[model samples]
Target: MLNFVDWLASTSGSIALRESLYMYPWIESAHVLFIAIFFGTLLFVDLRLTGYGFKNLSISQMNSKILPLTIIGFILMITTGLLLFYALPIRNYHNLFFRIKLFLMLLAGLNAWHFHRTMNRQGKAWDKNSFIPFWMKASATISLVLWGLVIISGRMIAYNWFDCDKQPQSELVNFLISCTVDPEIYEYLNGI
Candidate 1:
């Protein structure tokens, strides 16, 4: 998979986008904008679930009104994110924060899946009530935390603090991040 993605990363389109002076910034800006949009819309639903804000708006009404924006935001966010990754695959592939972000996204997705399933099954019963169940609120809280962590992790990807080429990493870190390199190259680069 890495080999295939490496090949794709080396393609002309990816290289062009990555090497372009202005295009990368524009794509990154779009990615950030969509992330804000998606998370902003999600905030309404989460707050509604927690019964802390949007109390006047019923769950069904909130879902009906805000779901479209949320979906659009999510779709665009994913599209921009993929384009960003396509531009630079190998660096992001070995990034610790990228791995962390992906894991958090998976957990967040599962939480969302369970939340949606339960909400769909029992939403009519309590959709109008200002008082929500503890489990639903808990789930929403978890979603907020996980997504926040995901964003932080994603942002951390730009930092090279733990880059694979940086030595003095533990054996486990090397294994986890595939930091192995030719000994001569390592020593020459590090002047060790």
Candidate 2:
């Protein structure tokens, strides 16, 4: 995996994206912009599901009005996010915060899947009503928490407090990051 990441980083496209004077910044900016668009629209729907906002709006109505924007934002965010990752595959692969972000993003995706499935199964009966299932509310709340942590960890990826070269990690932390995965990379990191 580390070798693959190194190969990716060495590719002409990745090198161009990473070394470009303006392209990297522009892609990163677009990523942040789309993340806001996606998370912002999703936030309203989540707040509604929690019965804390949009009391007059039905879940059906809120989803109808907000989900499109969320989907668009998500698509663009993902696109730019891939570009960002492609530009710095090795660095991101090694970053602890990046690892956390991926884990949390997966959890967030699962929560969303569960939420939508339940909403579809039981939603029509209560679509216009103020009675949301307790689980739905909990799921929405969990979504907000998970996404919040994802964003925070993603932002923290820029910090190097836990970089492999820092060498301050305990054995458990090293194990968690799978630091021993590639002997060559591990030796390189420790040698630095």
Candidate 3:
């Protein structure tokens, strides 16, 4: 599997694609943008579900509109996310926060899928009511929290685990570690 991933990474360095200069940054940028879109739409929809905004609009009506947008954003996020991971699978494999982010992402997906199934099984009953169901609210809350964790963990992976200076002088880096590095991206994170 490592060989396969290494080959996949190496092949992208061909004339058709400069992996580091072009593909890597592009994929990373797309991932961030898509995540923003996904989370922005999600915050709105989930807030609505929790009866914080758009109280006048029925939950069903809000879902009808926002759900499609959410799904679209999610598709973009997933696509770009995969490409970004493909670009740096080895780095991520050794990153602790990256592992945590993946776990959180899985939890978020499960939360979303379970909510969708339960809500569908309940039909229009929950939506028709003035007050949202307890479980639906919980699902929305968990979705937001888990997604937030995923984002934070992703950022932390670069800082906490993948510091090039801390990386051992070996052919492969197979674990996460906090270490000193030059060209610090987070100038304010001196103590970190």
Clashing pairs in 1: none
Question: In candidate 3, what are the lDDT values of residues 1-192, reduced to their tens digit?
Answer: 667756665665332333457776777788788888889889988998898887777777888888888789889988877666666666555566777788899999999999989877874787656676798899999999999999899778767434444444222332333223443434434434
Q: Against the unseen true structure, what C-alpha lDDT does each candidate score?
A: 0.86, 0.87, 0.73
Q: How good is model 1 by TM-score?
A: 0.91
Clashing pairs in 3: none
> Which candidate ranks first by TM-score, i.e. highest?
1
Best by lDDT: 2
lDDT of 2 at 189: 60
List, residue by residue over 51-72, the lDDT tens digit for candidate 2: 8678788888889999999999
The TM-scores, one per candidate, come to 0.91, 0.89, 0.77
Candidate 3: stretches off by over 4 Å: 13-22, 160-192
Candidate 1 RMSD to the correct structure: 3.0
